[model samples]
Target: MTTNTILFDLDGTLLEMQTEPFVKSYLVEVGRHIGDKYDTEKLLKLIWDATKAMIVNQDADKTNEQVFIEYFTANSEWEREEVWPLFDSFYRDVFPTLSHLTYPSPWAKKIVETAKAQGYRVAVATNPVFPREAIFHRLAWIGMSADDFELVTVYEESHFTKPNPGYFAEICQKLGVQPTECIMIGNHMQEDMVASTLGMKTYLVTNWMEDRGEPQYPVDQRGSLEELYQALTERTGVFAQA
Candidate 1:
């Protein structure tokens, strides 16, 4: 089937940032932001535990944000009422400032625009562990905007996280596209390539590649973001032939 949609992963794929350093910085900044009012270490632990909840989440009724907050409510000193404003403030004022951790991709904008110009539905298919502001700020770092895509997953609405087939399934369901109608593009060998299991075509971006023994899916194409740009704009390779 001809693919009509494209899903791009953020972070290492589009935004140029190593996953480990970026996440460590994020965890530290968030801890320092709200931890002054509470037990800092405990709060950090709570946040991670909540994050893990979102990753393994299976309940369709509960959004990842709800699951994260629920972990805090049930196991921590803070209440939902208290957590929202604190995290919201951090995401708005602090998260955007972390763009220094990620540099812009020279080809990110071109690939996205080429797909859009070709009338393909594009999604910033980043993991939905973070809030909308977090995702938007990261997109801004890569010289794109959340509004540029047909769908941008956020913790407030998403019920699954990366490497889980359910996450891709949820996105497919939301976009009204069959898995065979889309291409999943990213740098991570496992998390991004897992979309292939759902029958979505996979394109593995090599810059800042994360390979942790997830060679299960036979990648349909593999190269740099610039190569992806070529595939779309030049209308060649698996993308054009799909």
Candidate 2:
């Protein structure tokens, strides 16, 4: 029998928040900080443009961090070094304050504890878009702390983001586990289900699903955390009879 390792997504999976409201709040606040030079509307558009550029950024010549810095610097009048500190400040202070908009649900916390108790390696496989500080803050909003995870990917440390099979591969490599022994449980069809293509088990957390472009394989899908937790426990031969 294989030892089960559970990989989770952060934003919509563990932490609950309405996407639009959270984005609106984040952009509004970020805009205020940059407004001394750039207009709010323009700043928002620039961010979207930069994000789009990032999605297609596959050049071996530059890393994502470099690409973002280059794009950000090219579009703004601020010096490169100045931009980093400003963005870091916003992420550290203003980002955590957004935690007020998130609510804690018992199921998320319960599942993490159950997985750990069952001797599963529980890692947060959230896309490495934000810094570790931001990731911890969001986890705290859901009543889960860094101590709950065996591994948590942060933007500064990871070179690839999900939907890219390399990201899934890297996680398996780091954990010293085979792809078949791991299970990815996440809300995004494209990001989470990508693991299935690489021979890993996958669970679709439908309650907070995002319609990624498309999924390459069929996966075990569930609508709630309770259902997912039960399925995993049963599969791993760790579920106790009631």
Candidate 3:
């Protein structure tokens, strides 16, 4: 059987991120650059608020950028342009340095190449929470590149984020494939595994899985990327071609 697409999540799925350390380092670095202008706790709260708004935002009238900007302006009068440098300086410098908190999973890179060699369309369906540049840097840390994926969800380009069926729908429509023709592999049970509702096959990368209360959907569990590789071929019958 030919599986036309495989959608992978970044962050904890492809890249191993120790949540506390990464966030701590991130807040520290960004705080160092912009803290004096804004209260550190309040700034963090604003970011969380914007993220929550993004999760519940289903309005057809607004993009994520618009939602975030609207929420940002309402919460703090900071100019949008002023915040741009934080992303530029932080992701390029401080973020990369935080790589010490993460490591390349050779298994993850190998799986992508193996799937592509087997004629499956590969995509990084990472939540569109971060900018493309940030995603690109994370991919680089794992010895992958933006060019490795047929589709990569970036905030500016995507209207919907994960856990929302619309996010998966957008990728299907863009790739010209039905949801059933794609498989979503990620570590978040709530966010990534929810793709099954749209009929996409689901796999749990449990290396860094989060306990999301309880699962509302069924998924195949694989402990590591290496196991995922074998499981995908076995379950999809991709190996039968051999």
Q: Compose the digit string of candidate 1's lDDT tens values, residues 1-242.
A: 89999999998988878989999999899888986687878888988998999899899899998998888789987777877798889998999888888878668888888888998899989999988888988888877888899999899889999989999999999999999999999999889999999899889999888989845677999988888888878777757864
Q: What is the lDDT of residue 123 in candidate 2?
A: 95
Please write out the lDDT profile of model 3 over residues 113-209, one tens digit for every residue. Answer: 8888778899999888776777888899999998999988887778788788998998998899999888888888888989889888778888888
Query: Where does model 2 exceed 4 Å of error?
Result: 1-3, 59-63, 233-242
How does candidate 3 score on lDDT? Answer: 0.78
How would you encode candidate 2's per-residue C-alpha lDDT over 1-242 as one tens digit per residue? 36478888887788766666877888888888776764668657866676656556666455456666678778876576755676789888788888777766888888888788877899999877666788888888878788978899876566577777877887888888888788788887877788888888777787777774655566755567767778656753223222
Ranking by lDDT: 1, 3, 2
Better of 1 and 3 by TM-score: 1
The superposed Cα distance between candidate 1 and the true structure at residue 190, in angstroms, equals 1.3
lDDT of 2 at 121: 90
Candidate 2 residue pairs that clash:
none
lDDT, residue 225, model 3? 70
lDDT of each: 0.88, 0.74, 0.78
Top model by lDDT, which number?
Answer: 1
